[model samples]
Target: MKTRSMYKAERTSLNRLPDPVLETILCLLPTKEAVRTSILSREWRYKWTHIPKLRFELRDTTSELTSDIETAMNAMDMYDVYRVLLLHRGPIHELTLYFDHYWEHYEAFECDQIILHLLRNHTLNKLTLFGLYETEDIWYKLPASVFALHHLTDLHLCTFDIDHPSIFNGFGSLQKLVLSYVKISTKTLLHLLSNCPSLNTLDLHIDDYEHVDNCTINELLKCLPLIEHLTISGDVSQWLVLDSVPQELPTLIHLKYLCLNQYCISGDYGSAFLLALIKCSPNLEHAHLEMEYLLEFSVVKDKYSDVWLAHLNTLDLCFCSSSLEIEFVKFMLARSPKLKKVSILTVVDRKQDAKMVKTLLRAPRASRGVKICTWK
Candidate 1:
C-alpha cells in the first residue's frame, strides 16, 4: 500500500505534462499571470521563462494611487518588466510596451534600456511601442540598435521621433510599418521608406508640425513602389501636395485599398492631389474618403476623364452634401464598372437628404449590381 499524500501528489502533478504543453498553457494566460505561476510549484518556477511572447503595459492607475503609493507602484511595475526580461529564456518573438497617458514620469533612459535588453535576441519579429500621449516634450528617439533586428517584419510606433543616422542600414525584412502621431523630418521619412524595399502596407498619420522645404510629393510617391494598402490622415495629405499637384506619379500597380481621413479637398491643390493619386492607382478596389473641409469648387471632370476604376468594388464617402462632393460622386458612379457597394455618410435635413438620395439613385451607373447605402 502506497502513502496517500504521495499518491495524490503524483496523480495531480503538472510536472507530468511535457515542457511544450506547459509553455502552451502559459502562453494562453496574460504575461503577468503567467509569471505568477512560478510560486505554484518547483517544476513551474522556470516554465514562464521559456514563454516567447511578452506584453507589458502601464495602465491608467491615477484613480487608485496616492502620491507616495503611485511612486512605489511605478517602481514596482518597472522592476517587474526588467525582472521578466532578465530571467526569461529563449528568444522573445514579440514584445509590446505601452505606457498609458497617466504614466507621466517614464524616462527615455528606461525605454532605451528596455530596447537594449530586446537586442540580446534577434528573434523579435513583431514589436509595438506606444509612448505617453500627453508628454510631447519627451520623445523616445529610436537608437541604432533598433535597426539591428534584421528579422523584424512588423513594426508599430506611436509618438516617437526618428533621427536618421549616417551609418544606418534599414529593416530589410520589414513588410508593415505604422507610425501614428510621429514626428520625423521629410528627409528621415524618405530615408526610412526608401530602405524598406519589402514594405507593402503603411499607415502614416504624422503630428501637425512645420515640415521641411524638401517634402515633395513626387519623391515620396517613388519610395512606396510596392505599397498595397495605405492610410494617410491629418496634415500629411496636405504636405504631399505642398509643392504642386504631381503631373505624373509612378503607377501603384500593387495598391488595392486607400483610406484618406481628415483629408483636405478645399482648394485646387487638394482636389488636384486627390485626382492625381486616384489616376495612378488604376487597380484600386476600395476607396474611403473622409473630407476635412468643405470644397470650394467642384473637381474638374476633364482632369481625370481617362481614368477608369475597372476593379473597384467598394466606395465609402464621408462628406457634406456640397455641390463639389456631389459632382465627385456622380463621376465615380459613371467610371466604376465593377462597383458593388457604395456607402455615403453625410449631414443633411430630411428634405435635402431625400433629394440627395434621389440624385445618386438617378446617377448613371456602370455596375448594375451596385447597392447604395446612406446614413446621417
Candidate 2:
C-alpha cells in the first residue's frame, strides 16, 4: 500500500492562496517570525515585505541559563538588530525597537545608523523605543526627519535622551504622545504640544525630581488646547507651593477623565486647587482622588463650599487618611443634588467595610437619583 503525500498536497493548497490573505497572516506575526515564513515556499518569500507592523527585540533571544547565557548575550548585539531593520523596506505602520547597554561598543554605532535609515522612511504611524540609554559619547537625539512624518499618530519614548527642541517642531497630525524617564525642559514640551494640535491623550512619568523645575503644570497645560484625557504622575511635593496656583484653564474644560496619582492635595493649597477646578472646569463630570486629608468644614466654609461641590456626577475617593468620610459624603450629597454615582475606594482589603457600604447603598437616600458605592 502506498502512503498519502500529505506535505505535497498541503504545500500546493498553500500556494493557491492569494497574496493578500498570506500578507494579512504574515502581518499578524512578529518581524522575525514573519521573515522566517520565507522558507515555506517561493511565493511566501517576500510576503514579509508587505507587512505593515515591525517589532524587533534583542532581549527575547538572550538565554538566562548559566551555561549558554554568555554566548546568547554575545549574540544579542544591537548591530545585528539594526542590520535586520535596514534590510526591511516597507511602509511600517508600527515599529518597536528596544536597546540595552550590555551590547558591545560597535552595536551603538549600528543603532544610530538604523535610526538614520528609519528617518528616510515616512510611513511610520506609531513608533516605540524602550530601554534606550546613552552610552559613552554616543549621544542620542531625536532626528529632524521624525518631526516631518505627518502620518505618525502615536509616539512613545522611554529612557531616551532628547537634547534638541527642533526634533518635535512639525508634528501636526500626532494624536497621542507618551514620555517616561526622559530629560525634557518645559520649553521643549511646549514646542512639542504646540506642534501636535490634534493630540487627545498625554502621559508623562518623571523618575527624577531635578527635571521638575524645567516644566511647570501651567506651562505643560498650555501646550495641549484640545486634550480630552490627561494623566499626571510625579513627585509634586516640591512644586506644591500655594502661590503657584493656576488662574485659569480654559482649554481643559472639555476634559472628561482626570487621574492624579501619588499627589499631595493637603492644606489651603488643596482647597485652592479644588476651587480652581470648580471655576475653570465647568464640564468636568468624572473625578478620581487619592488625597491625604479630606478638606475640613472650616476650610470649606472659608473657601466657599458651593463653588467646588456643585456640578459633580461621578466621584471616586481612595486611600484617604482623614476621619471626615461621613462628613464629606454628607456634604457632597447635599451639594451635588444631581449626583448619579459615587464610589468610595479603599486601598486596604476590608470585607466588613464593603458589606457596610452595601448596607448603606440599600438604605433609602434623601436624593432621588443618587447611587453610592464603596469598593474596598
Candidate 3:
C-alpha cells in the first residue's frame, strides 16, 4: 500500500503536468469544484482561471433551504460568476449559465453586465443560457451585442428575446441554433435566418404563434435550404396552415432528420401541411412525430402524387390509437421502400394498442425487412 508521503509526491508530480493538460483536466470539473482546486497547492492556485470553457448553474433551493439562505446563496453564486470572468486569464471558447430562480424578482441588470463583459471576447464557439421560465416579462432580453459573436458555431437560447434585429450583424460561422420559447418577431426571425449561410441544424419552439403567420412561415422554410436536421414543436406546427395549405414551398434538399412535437395531422389543411413537408424532404432518413390528435371524420387521403421516401430508414410515432394515425402508418409503410424499423408509442388502452400494433404488422410494406415495434 502507498504511504502518505508517496501519495503527496504523486500529487505533486501530477500537478506539474503541462499547462494545456492541466487546463483540460480542470475544464472537465464543475466550475465551483475547479475553483476549489486552488486550495490544493501553491502550483494550482490559478490553474482554473485559464480554463477555456465555463459553466455556472444557480439552482433553486426552495424545498431544502430557507428563503433567506436560498437568496444569499443565489447572490453569492452570481457574484462568483462575475469573479470567474474577471480573473479568467485566457480566451473562453464556450460558456453555459442556467439560472433556476424561484424568487419573485431577479436583477436583470447584473445579467446584462455579464453579457457585456462576454462581448469583449469574440472567441466563443458555443453559448447556452437557460432561464427559469418562459414568460417574456421575466425572461432575459438579449442585448444587440450578442450578435457580434462572429465565431459562434453552436448557440442555444431559452426564454430570451431580442429587441433590435436592425443592429444584428449575423453569425456567419453558426451551424446549429436552438430557440426555445424565444419571443422574436417575424421580420427579425427572417433576418436572423437569412444571414446564417452555414446553418444546418435548427430546433425552433415558439409559444407565441399569434404574432407569426403562414407567409412568414413559408419564408422561414425558404431561408433554411441547407438545413439537414429540423425540429418544430409547440403551437408553431399548427400555425403552418393558418392562412392556407402550402402548395409549393422551397424544397429542403439536405434535410435528413425531422421531428414534430404536438403536431396536428387532422383535417384537409393539416394533411396538406404535413404532406407538403414530406414531399419536399425527399432525402429524409429519420422522422419522429408526436401527434396531438387525428380526427377520423376529417382525415384526408393522399393528395400529393409521385411522392416517395426512398431514404427513410426509421420512423417513430407517438400518438393515440386513432384510425387516422394507423392509416398514416400504413401509408408510410407502403411508400418507404428502404424503411428498416418503425417504433410506435401508443397513448391508448393496452388492449387497443396491441390490436393497433397487430394491424400495422399485417399491413403491406414496401420493404419486406421492415420491423414494426410498439409499446403502450
Per-residue lDDT of candidate 2, residues 1-376 (tens digit): 3346777678789988897787788767666777778898777777787677777655533535436655344334465666556666666688776655433334435555655566676367898876645443333444444555677889887765554433445677788888766656555666778778899888865554555455455666667777776665654544433446665645476676666663535555665555454455555677676665655434453444544444568877674424454444555556665578877776545775565465445444424667766665
The residue pairs in collision within model 1 are: none
- Compose the digit string of candidate 1's lDDT tens values, residues 1-376: 8898886687457789888888889887667778888987777788899888777766544446546754434333667788888899877988877776534555556766777778765488888888766766655666556666777889998887777668778889999999888878778889999999999999997774664334777888899999999888766654554547655778999999998874544544666767778889999999998764665435445767887889989999888887778878888888889888989888777677778878887888833777887788
TM-scores, all candidates, are 0.84, 0.75, 0.86
Candidate 2 CA-lDDT value? 0.61
Best by lDDT: 1
How much does each candidate deviate from the true structure in C-alpha RMSD?
A: 4.6, 5.2, 3.6
Better-scoring candidate (TM-score), 1 or 3: 3
- Sort all candidates by TM-score, best to worst: 3, 1, 2
Q: In TM-score terms, which candidate is top?
A: 3
For candidate 2, the 10 contiguous residues with the lowest summed lDDT are 134-143
TM-score of 3: 0.86
- Residue pairs clashing, model 2: none
Separately for all candidates shown, the number of backbone clashes (residues 3 or more apart, or on different chains) is 0, 0, 0
> Model 1 residue 352 lDDT?
77
Identify the superior model by lDDT, candidate 2 or candidate 3: 3
Cα miss at 313, model 3 (Å)?
Answer: 0.6
